[model samples]
Every structure is written in C-alpha cells, then in structure tokens.
Target: MTHETRSSRRNFLAASSGLVAAAAMPPALAQTAPFLITSATDVLLPKGKAQRVVICGGGWGGLNAAKQLRQLAPQLEVVVLERNPVFFSCPMSNKWLVGQVDTNFLTFDYLKVSEKYGYRFIQTEILAVERDRKRVVTAAGSLDYDYLILSPGIRYNYEAWFGNDRRAAEATRARFPAAYVPNAEHFRLKQAIEDFKGGEIVMTLPPPPQRCPPSPYERACLLAWHLKTKKIKGHITILDHKDGIRPIGLGFRQAFEELYKDQITYVPNAQVKEVDPFNQRIKTAAGDFKFDHAILMAPHQAGDLAWKAGVIGKNAEGKPTGWSGVDPLFLNLRDDRDVYVIGDAVGIVSPQFLFYPKAGHVANRHAKIVARYIAERAAGREPAYSLPDNLCYMWVSADPQQAINVQFDYKIGDFQDKGKVILQTQIDDNERRPELIVEDFRWFGYMREDLFG
Candidate 1:
C-alpha cells in the first residue's frame, strides 16, 4: 500500500502496454495509459466501506445483474465496468434498422442505470483479469473485487469464414456489415440497407451455437419486407447453413413462402467456402453467389474479456465453446466460487442435452438467478438452485406488425448430474401472428423499464 508499491504497479502496467511513461501515447490508449494501479489506490472511485462486486460489460446480462444485486444486497459495492458511454439495446435493434422504430427507442443512458441503481459505472477498456490476485486490470488501472461477475458478451470469429484473410474480412465488415454485434456495425449496416437502390442483396448464416439462432432469418424477412414495401426493385438471396428456418423453422418457412415469396430467395445447406469482399462475391457449399450489397455474419465466440479472464469452457464433446466455464446450474466458475458468468458468453454445457440460447432474454434470466445466488452466499446461507426461463420474439412483418416467439423452460432432469442440466422448450402458437407482435413490443417495453430504471 506504500506510494513506492503503487508507483511500481503503475510502471508495470504502463510497461505491459509497451509504453513506459507514455506522455506521447495515442489518444485512445492514453485515457487509461493501460497502467496497472494497485488496489490500495481508490482509482475506481473511493472504495467506500462496502465489499465490492465488479460486473464486467454493460450489456443485457451485466445490467440485469447490477439491478438485482443492488435490490437484494444493498450493502454490496456494485461497480459496472463498460467501454461504451451509452447503452444500445440489441434486442429491438432490428426494428430500428427497418424504420419500425427510431434510435431513441433502442438507446439508453448507461451511467443513469448506475446512478439510479446505486452502483458505480466505470468506462474503461478491460486489459486483463488477474484471477490469482482477484483483481481486474483496466486501462485506467486495476481494482480488486470480492465477487466478480463477467458478462462480456460475444466476439466475432472471422477466422472460421475469413480464415487468415484479414484483408477480405476487414473489407467485408467495412462495406457490408452483418450488424449482429451491438456496435458501429449496426449503424453501418443500417445505412447500407437504406442506400440500396436495387439488385441482388446477399446474406449468409452461420452454423449452430451462435448468438440468437433465429436472428439471421428474422433479418432476412425484414430485409425482404423493406424491399417489398419500398418497391426498391431489389431481391434478397439468403444462403443459409441450416436446412431451413431455425429454432422455429416451420413457421419462418411459412412466412417466407406466404409473404415475401417472390422477392426473397432462400438457399439451404449453404455453408461458406470463400469470401471475396472486393468483388462482392461468395462461394458456398450450395453454389456461388454474387450480390450488389450484402450482410455477412461470422461465427461468434465469447467476448475477449471472457477469454482474458480464462473462464471459457467446452461442450459435451470437450471442444471449446469460447464461453465461460462454470457450474451449469449455479452460474459460478468451476474453480472459483466468488466468480460468475452469464449472458451470451456462457459456455454451452451440452449441445446434445439442453443448452441455453445466446439471446438477451436468456441473459436477463441469467442475471436474476446469479444475483440471488451471490446475495444468498453473502448472507452465509446456502443458496437454493433456480433455473432461468427464456423467451425470444422475432418480428417478421413491419407492414402488419406480425411476429413469432419461442420459450425455453429449463429444469434438472431426473438423472441430472453435477455440471450437466436438461432443458425443456415450448413455442406459443409457434407461428407468425399479429397478436404476438404486440406482445413482443410489450415485453421489450417492460424489460427496458426494469433494466434502465
């Protein structure tokens, strides 16, 4: 705790960033200087008298965890570390892209969530997580945590599709964005879709275990809808890896055929082979396709922070899922009880059995359960196990405001063992309907109020 030790830590952190006494560091890196400040220094605000619980990433799961943790355990010092200044909701973002709603509907105050919910919000890029030291290294400095919850979200796996072709990957992302990630890609993709005058619009879908299984198809429907409604004289060609629509395949296929049959072309079993972004061309398993504009989705992995924290686990096959390795039912790391993970970054326990979908709804449910367990453990009580209920709705039509939904109910199987659990699913009226669209928006509204309040 001496000044000498603090100075050493700062010097060490700066050196780690390859910049010692970096007075001339770049503007972005200079903010935090990537310095590792000792925990003794109250850099993340005055530590106060409460035991600190640090939640990484300010997305759906992290925000929900902060909200519930503050409600259940008023004494804990909850600090949310996020890189972004404002929260942009990805759940209803598709609606915003198609002009069904405005930007205000999807944007929320990130710091306000902290202010209203009695937590400190720190805006800093997470550099590393020294689990052995029970501290998180941020660009600003480092802070120790009594309990840590990581919900850092997903990272794109461009390697699967683009491989070592970094140039092609960068070009594709720059011109034709997938908009799957909740970042600048959203805005860029929106502008691309609007600026389309006419021609073949190409879209690609990745394999299973990706975030939001039904999202690609839902977006296809919306894109087709935009073309039809606007009379843009454009056609959409969807090269899907799966056989048909996913999660709710039957219903989505019905929508595609009945609604946008002429304007949209659905190609199945079309795995990606090669991508030539400069030429607006792609070769798939099904066939070769070229387009005037495109939306591309690379496979996804857990966020970099999750990997940096070293919590990524494997599936039943013992293959890396690029997500947090944790006790399936408890949502805590296998090796450390004080650390937990939720949201899309959570590793799939068993692909054959029942795995939680990487969706915002599932993450919200995950936050509530994780909050309760943390609170119970803090109170010196053995926490009871509870499962998350996940429901996701996709809007298929902006004209009639029609949508479809899927619900998953998770429970322990009779033969369930440690680190493995079973899931039960239900689809309500499992088809596109006008009534479900209202329910979808209503659910979105209620969730926003609960989270952003």
Candidate 2:
C-alpha cells in the first residue's frame, strides 16, 4: 500500500495512425535507455534510474499485478494508471442494491493500496499505446515500459446490439439500471426498488463473454428474496439470452428450483430486443414482458478503449477480433517483448467442457502469471506463464447464507484439460450453515484487498 510519486516521461510519438516504434522493434533487441535487472529471474527494470513496469487498469488484474510485482521485484519501478479514484466491488454490490448492506461497504479507496504498495498511482485515461516504442500514452504524458500488463476488463456492446435504444437504455439505467458497476447503477436500481409498490421485476442476462456470467441470475434471485421478505407482492423473472444457465447448468437449476422457485421465474433461451419504457414492457425473441422494473444485462465486448486503440483486429466476418480468437495468443503482439495482454482483454482458448468467460477471480489469477512472465522477460530471461484457477460464488438470495459455488483449475496450454472441474456447491434454506456465511465474507474481504483495495 506504499504510494510512489508520479514520474515524468516523454509522450509516445505515434509515427503514423496505426504503427509505433516499440511494435516495430524485434523481440531480441534491447533498448539503450535506463533499465533494471533482478538477480534471481533477471527481470528487466525500467531503463535508467529504475526498471519500469506499467500496468493499465486498477481492477482485479491490474491491482494484483501491481502488488505482486512490487513485492517480488522490489527494485523495479511499478506504476498503475486508473481513471477512477475509488473502485466499486461488483462482488458484494447486490446486497447494497437490495437495502441489505450500505453502499459504503461496497466502495473502496485506492489510496490505501497506493500508499502501502509502492506503486505510483495516476488518475487518468490511457489515450493510446505505441507498441513499437513500448510506451503508453495518456493525457498527462507517455510512459516507457520494460514490460506492460493490460487488464482493462469488459465493456458493454451497447452500440452494436443495443442499437438505437442505447441512449435510452443508458438513460433508463438510472432506475432500471443494470447495476453492473454498483455506483450509479446501484443507486438508481436502489431508488427503483424503493419506489416499487409490487409488480413484475425482470432481470435479463446477455450472451457469453461477459464480466460475470452468473451475475444476472444471482441478481434476480437476490432481488426476489428481498421482495419476498419486504412483503412485496411481485414475481421476479430472469430472461436469459442463452438456452441454459451457464457451464454449470445443473447446479444453477438445482439452486433455483429447490430454493427460490416460489419467488422467482426462470426463462432461458430468450433475447431481449427492446424496452418500451412508456408501456413498461420488454420486447424479446421469446415474447414481450411487461414489468414494473426491468434490468437488462446487455451484451459485452472488450472495453471500447481496446477497440479505439486499434489493438483489436477484425477478421473477414467484420467482428472485432478481440478475445474471440480460438487461440491463447489472441491479441498478443509482443513487439520488442514490451506488450503483454492478460485477463478479459486477451482471448485465451477455452475448453469444451466449460467456456472460459470473464470473471474477477480469473482476471486476478491471470494478471499474476502475466506479471511474473513480463518481469522475467524484462531481465533478459525467457517468459513463462502459470496455470490459472477460477473461483466464483453466486448468491441465491439476500439471506447472505444461500449461494452456489463453481470452481475451475485450468492449465495454460492444453485445451483439453484447460478447465478441470474442482467443485460445485448449492446452499439451500435448510442448509444455510452460519459457518459458510462467515467463510464467504472472509473470502470476499481477501478478494477486495487483493483486487480493488
């Protein structure tokens, strides 16, 4: 949690619209500028006074890399550039939206992490990346990196799929907000729930490759639990874009049917096309749903930042080849060994058993391995990434006790055993063990500190 003062660096001069100096550098070549080299792994420090490692994004993946790199490679200078002063944790946000927990509990300060972790924190937007020069461009200045780790998370594909209603959807986000980030969305959704006298409430799930796959269902169930407890006479319906719940369909079904069936209605293989705010109805592939409140978990893609930066290449299909590639090296343009893509940004191969969707836990784990690998290559050593394990808990209701768990262990290269089933647990009303609730809180706390805090 140690904070470092921001250092001045030259701006990345983009030679042309698309190309840069770093991207043009050969992998074997080394820069003459200032750099640091570690003893054990030969991690290259930023050139000159300190070896610099620049990490983009301050969420789970970025923060984890910053913390770990500062600890392991103490000599290397670490800098984290984030656009926000405070980060909102989407993990425990559902509780806040339902009036069960305070919004303050879901918000965390980056100062603690910056002050203690020896990471220079800058609050700014990354304008672009000069791959050939191995530099990052921001409104403030440009940053040269011995190695770079990119983990900007996911973005809503509102423009493509949401279409002309994008603005209206964003406007309605205040009351029937997606509650995705838990700041604006949380407050708006909270207000909507408070004003509700009791009617139909719908929460829709989009297609795959979203930040949190089980979130919509978990959110729907949590809201249903809240309404039932408040004596609100309303039915909670979850309109899913996919045919089933997710990779662990059986576990999801068991949780809904056995625990929340009374208060919730599950609709799968549904696609919501539009929302008539005036009529209070949702138009979808299945049919039209009239509800008092509607929550659309819109489709997503790699953050717009990536698309804007020209980092995402398009195929013949006209779809931006962000992480949709079937290869682990998707979007990995390693010019001069300067740039490294991890987390939701990079399209890693997914095993047929369970699709590798984006999640905070997975992103955090991915960042560590990528950070270590980048650090190794900086010191003139070969880079190697480790296997990543994913763990996520879906809340069944606001009871804080009922939940479902799915765990995965993935190997880096082998697509067949990429994801090995670890465990899946369902928590029923009768099985609401107090110890598990305590465990869940403890896990979330560790996760918060490791990621956002």
Candidate 3:
C-alpha cells in the first residue's frame, strides 16, 4: 500500500471502535498487550455484597477497572478517586510536543467518563488507606469499601538527589521542564523548546523502578531529531545513572547510531550528584557541567500514602520501600483476599517482563483483570486473575514513518525470568504497518476514553 493509504489504515485501526477488535486479539497481533502471560482460571472469585471495590487514581488502571466493573456488574457500586479532572496522555504526547500532533487531542476529561460510566468521581488526594477497616480517607471524605484498588502512580524523589537545590526544580520548570507528570510543566517544556536558540540541552534519566523506563531515551532521541532537523546548534546530552543504557539497551543503541548520530551524546554511569539551579550547573559522578536547559528525570516511588498505610514493603529497618506486593492480577500483597494494586504503585514485576516499565498499557490491562474479578465477586462467584502480555512501541520520528517495539509475557511469581517466550517486531526505517499505527492510535485513544473519556 502507498504511504498515505497505510497512514489512513493505521488511523482507522486507532479509532474508537477499533479498541474492542484490538483488545480481542492476542498480544502478538495487537503489539500492545500488557501482562498477558499465563491465564488464571476462575478459582478465587469473590461473591455478593461481600465485594465493594473503591479504586483510587483515575489513571489507566483504576479507570479501566471502573469501566469494566460497570459493564460487567451493573448493580455493583464503584467509586473512582482521582485528583485530576482530565488526563493528559503521556503516550503520543511527545508527538504533540514536537508539533506532530495537536495538544488538545492529548487531553481527556473525566467528567465525560463520570457521565458515561456511572461511577463516582472524587477529586481528592488519598491521605491514607486503612486496610484493616477497608476504608480510605481522602481530603474530601472517608470512603468505606470491601475491596480497594490503589493505582496512584509513581512519585518523584526530588529531595534525595536535589538536596537544597529546590531552585533547580524551579529552574527546570523555567527551562526544559520534565513534562512527565503532564500539566503546566508539559506546556512550559514545549515553550522552552520554542524559545531556545540552542546551546547545551541536557536530559537526565532516572534510576530504575521509575515510570515508563524507555520514555526518557525516547524523549531525548525525539528532541534531538527536532533540534537537528530544525538546525538548532549545541549538543543534546543524555546523562544516565547506570554504566549501561536501558531495558532494551541493545535495540536503543541500534536506534541511536542509525538515527540520532552525533546529535545526541551518551554519558553512561554518570549519576547526577546535585544540581545548582542558581548557576545552572549539574554536578554528576563524573564532574560538574553547565547547560542552557536541563531536564532531570529523578528516581521515583509510591509516595507517603503507602508508607502511612503500612502497605508498602518495609526494609530491614522498617522504612517504606517504593511499592506494595501484588499478584499476577495486581491484587494487594498484604491481603490478596479482596484488594488490588496497579500501575507504578504495584511491586510485582512479571519474570517474563510482561508488565515491565509500568506504562499506561500495562496499567490498563491490570484494570481489566481487577474489574473482571470485582464483577465476578459481585455476582456471588469466584474471580480469576490472569497475567498480562505487554507490547511496548517506541516512535522515533527522525525516521517518522517507522516504529520499534518490544514484546513479552509474564507468569505469576516468575518476575525474575523473561519467561520462555519473548516476541518483538521492528517496523523498519521506511516500512509502515497500518495496523501498528492503528494500534498506537487506538491504544492511546481507548486508554484516554476508557479512563477519562
């Protein structure tokens, strides 16, 4: 097919109704499965009024579960707790930031979702989770539930690395903001690019156990492409914490050599010790350096709520770790009897890398399992939880027509292995799969719609 024809086809695949078809397909075909490993039969489904599911965070996991619960169990009451009224999608958003896609399309309103899904939307932050009482206390009110799903997502640890350099954050917010959180920072970052005359533009990668692991490199590459194409001068520096690169490090190397070339510089094992916003200098393990603009993607965690609730695993000294334990289906680690945890807030990593990176796709898939389980329980039946297969796609627009993907599956309790099966597809420099593009569009759209549509 012609390029235009192929683009059209992919767009069609990504349209609203296309999600049902895409979701029905196996991960190999969809190239977008999250945590689809081994399937679990209906063994531990809960029954009747015994299940009151209160999902926290209106992001992918909680929102997806809320939608599924309403669809599968119409009589069961579901409440979604989200601090934001609209969700600004992180996937495909980079395209928008680079002026490829419009910014408006990336924004989805939860009010529409509240109307369609018939679920309660409490715009409040969760202060604490009383698991013993089966209750959650928020800034707005206290909610009681039989089952709880926490998907509050990852929180950046600025104090650990930044120290007294709080101004570094402000400087970043004033310069190349880390739009990873999707708000004013996102737009501000875009504007910084628009205003840049181009000097040393630096982007740092966070340590592991952070959200969207591959995203930093993707962002750096895309930004470099934009700078090169726009003929902006100066070096595009990527400072990483580890001695090596990221998850699909080899593939990324291929991508870097083929695409970014000398436009981007790689600094390995160069951890940023501290950043001086006053002088715009970043002190790293290697040494100190100054930049015209910088973005520090810091290490992240599950935040204070998990610690206050005594849910997240504690260290030998009883300090809170990043996340709580979760099963294959993302149920709570402490008491899988009735709770579910999803997204970066979850601690269980599939040995098969099925649910790696904690991306939006993985969160959505976990939502389906949690919702299905909740629905089954409401009907006085046992709910089964299954593993999710994940297909992660990276769009490097230097060669805008193509995309690269990594696919994997997970088995419960096998988070350390890559399972026996791993699937991957590289769309090549010029090859275009309409279905893949369609899957991308549909994936983000459905994710937005299903969550905050």
Candidate 4:
C-alpha cells in the first residue's frame, strides 16, 4: 500500500468525531472504521527539533507503532530498541513445532523492516528505564524521548515454580522446553517429538492471561495429529490448570472427542505442585504423572524492564499485579502519561473493567491507536481516544485443512459497579472448513505487510 493509502485510512478515523460513540453508530460506519474513539483534548506543542518516540520491543506492537507513527508524522524521529536482531512470530509457530512449516516461514529480518519503514532499529538490551529523566539506559547507550512506547512482551514466571533457585529453573526449562516464546525452544521441542519412539508425551498449560489463550489447545491438537499421521505409538496428555479449556472450549472439546480421542488425553484443573525434572515426573494437585517427553508452559509476567522501572507492581489493594497500569482508552501509563504501554505488558488493576487479551492481533491494533494519539498531539490537536478490535484464527488440523476463528469488539460503558469496557465476541466453529486454513495464511501475510511493508 502507498503512503497516501495508509494515511487516508488513519485520517478517516481521525476525521470522524462520531466514531467515539461507535457502539451506537450505524452498521455502515462501524464496518468501515477500525477503532472506536472515546475522547479528545487539545494540548500545547513543545519546542524541539522534532518530537521523538522511542519504542522498546520490535514485535507486532512496537513495529506497527513505529511504522504508523512515521507515516502519520513524517518529521518525527522514531527509534526502535530490540534485543533480537531477527523477528520471530509466536503466532502459528505451533506449526513449526509440529513439523508442518519451516522456521523460516515465521522469521523475518529487522533490517528489512527498518529500511522499508524509515525507522532506526537498534539491537540492544534495555538495562533500565529512568522515567523521571525521560530516558532509557540500554547496553549500548542511553536515549531520551518525548514519548516512550513499551511493547516489551512477557517473561516466564520461573520463580513461581522453582522458588529462588535459578539454576534449577534453567535446568527444568532445558529438559522440557516451552515453545511459546518463539525461539530455539521450537526446535528443542520438535526434536524431542521426532525422537520419541513410543510411550506418553505430556504438555502442561499455565493459568490464563497468557499471550495466546487458544495456543495450548492448538499445540495439543496438532501434536496429536502429528502422532496419528506419522503412525507413532504414543499418547499425548494435556494438563491444564483451568477446570476445562475455555475461550473456545466447545470447539476444542469437539476436536478432542471426534478426532483424536484415542491419541490424546486431556486432564483439566491439574495444578502443578512440584516438577521433578531429574526423574521426568510432574506432581500436580490432581495426581503425579510421568512422561517420556514434556513441554511445560510456565506462568507469565511482564518483562523485567517494566518491573525494574517501577511501571508494574502492586495495585491499590496491595495485590501483586505483574503488568503496567495504563489508560485503557489511549494506552498511556496512568501514573506517567508521556509513557505508553501496549501489547502483553498492559496490566489491569482492581475495579477497572478493561479486558483486552494479550494477542498479536490486539497488539497490532494497539499500535494504530498509540500512533494516532501521538501524531495528533504533536500537531497541537487533541486526538480522540479509541479502543481496538481483535481478530484471531487457530489451526486445528493440517491434513484436513481445518481452522477456527474468533473476533472481538470492545466499547466503553458506564462506570457503574462494573468494568468500564464491555466485550462482544463472535466465534465461527460450527463448520471446520478448509478455506479457513487458506485464510489463515492470508491473515498472517496481511498483518505482516501492514506493519513492515
């Protein structure tokens, strides 16, 4: 798409003041607009060479945010800090673990995205965030910014499982890889699966609020499919902490029963009490289970940068919440307005009713909102606040080419004794069509192009 086309799409939403009340808008208007504007306010422009936006983490949220910010305000300097030189997508990476697709299909060069989008990309680890000084200290150097955007993703909560023994946690991670992070873990798990001759393969699911809600189930289904197709003599066991699969419970339940009932065993509400990697045994509240091979999806928390910066901590109720508190409408830090938090790092405190899932598509949508907000503010105009929508698809089978989809819309509601934002979800699972599999590739392509191309 041309620069003009991209700007026009963003401007269309900016020009429509009535889009703020999108819940009551006409169907025609709602269908065309991508977000619902919530509020607007004028602000004085600061004196500088050009407003600078320093974005941390070059994944979906940060990349899209930098791209859109440059498109909206060509004069502004957009800098991205990412530790990884190459970008690997977590979405659809389960296919790679199951040997359905090559790793190259899910990896991209950061230099290409930087060159195409005209943004400065730095491959350096962020050491600390000096919020009061408006600068971030990195392993390379420190950089100041007028506005900071954090999409630092998440970190595994290993302490929750292994206490203060870091070595034990690392050893356990090496034994049973969690491929959810989209890196070497993918290959580790894939090799283990390929080398397995027979016996039982175990996979554990962490509590909710993880990056992708449907991912564990998707992995289980695909692994089961792999076992049956390859004629491997093995049974796959899924241990979930929740009472049952959720968000798309009905769809996954049907898949387990109708297709892989014999090859897969699902045990829900099986909370892990102890993990004995030395003996290849997992002791859970329900019972102790042994496995020939295992994959443990550890509990998740915000990246350490957020915690070190004091951006995420206990809430008013003194409960430890491992995310940064942000204004739901604009995604800016509630305590420090100049800093914005997006993607999986966004946290919700008590009595606040915002329910945005930590998914790639949701993060992509957040990038647009933050980009618009910064662009309008720099131009001495008040940008209307907006809420993002989510579109997600999960693959169930490769041979049969079947998939499931979910779409969600959010709207601001009255702040009575309820959450401030309301969610309306629509799911398509009645018929598992092969066309959805085709659309799955199309969706990934469109998203990548939208952010990087």
TM values, all candidates: 0.88, 0.80, 0.79, 0.86
Candidate 3 Cα outliers beyond 4 Å, as residue runs: 1-51, 163-176, 328-330, 350-355, 412-439
Quote the lDDT for 283 in model 2: 81
Clash count for candidate 1 is: 1
- Residue 90 CA error for candidate 1 (Å)? 0.8
**Candidate 4: 10-residue stretch with minimal lDDT:** 37-46
Candidate 2, number of clashes: 28
Q: Against the unseen true structure, what C-alpha lDDT does each candidate score?
A: 0.82, 0.65, 0.67, 0.78
Clashing pairs in 1: 311-325
- Model 2 whole-model lDDT (C-alpha atoms): 0.65
lDDT (tens digit, per residue) of candidate 3 on 190-307: 8887888879988877777777777777677678778878889857778888787666676567667777786788888778787766677888886677898887676777745556
Q: Poorest 10 consecutive residues of model 1 by lDDT?
A: 25-34
Q: Which candidate number maximizes TM-score?
A: 1
Q: Quote the positional error of residue 72 for candidate 2 in Å.
A: 1.5
Q: List, residue by residue over 300-404, the lDDT tens digit for candidate 4.
A: 888877886778857679876888877767888878888988888888722443347788998998899999999998898998888778777777788887887
CA deviation > 4 Å runs, candidate 1: 1-48, 314-319, 351-354, 415-420
TM-score of 2: 0.80
Q: Candidate 2 or 3, higher TM-score?
A: 2
lDDT of 2 by residue, 1-453 (tens): 111211211112222321343354322112322222112122222345667788888877788888888766766777788887787877777766776668777777887766567676677777777666777777555668777777777776665444677566665555566766536666777788788888888877877767777767767767777777888887888888888777556656776787667778888878878766556778888888988778866676766556644556456788775553323532245333456566676653543533355777777777777777766666668765455667766666556566666667654433345444322232223233345456668878888767655
The C-alpha stretches of model 2 lying farther than 4 A from their native spots are 1-48, 164-166, 313-318, 322-336, 351-355, 412-435
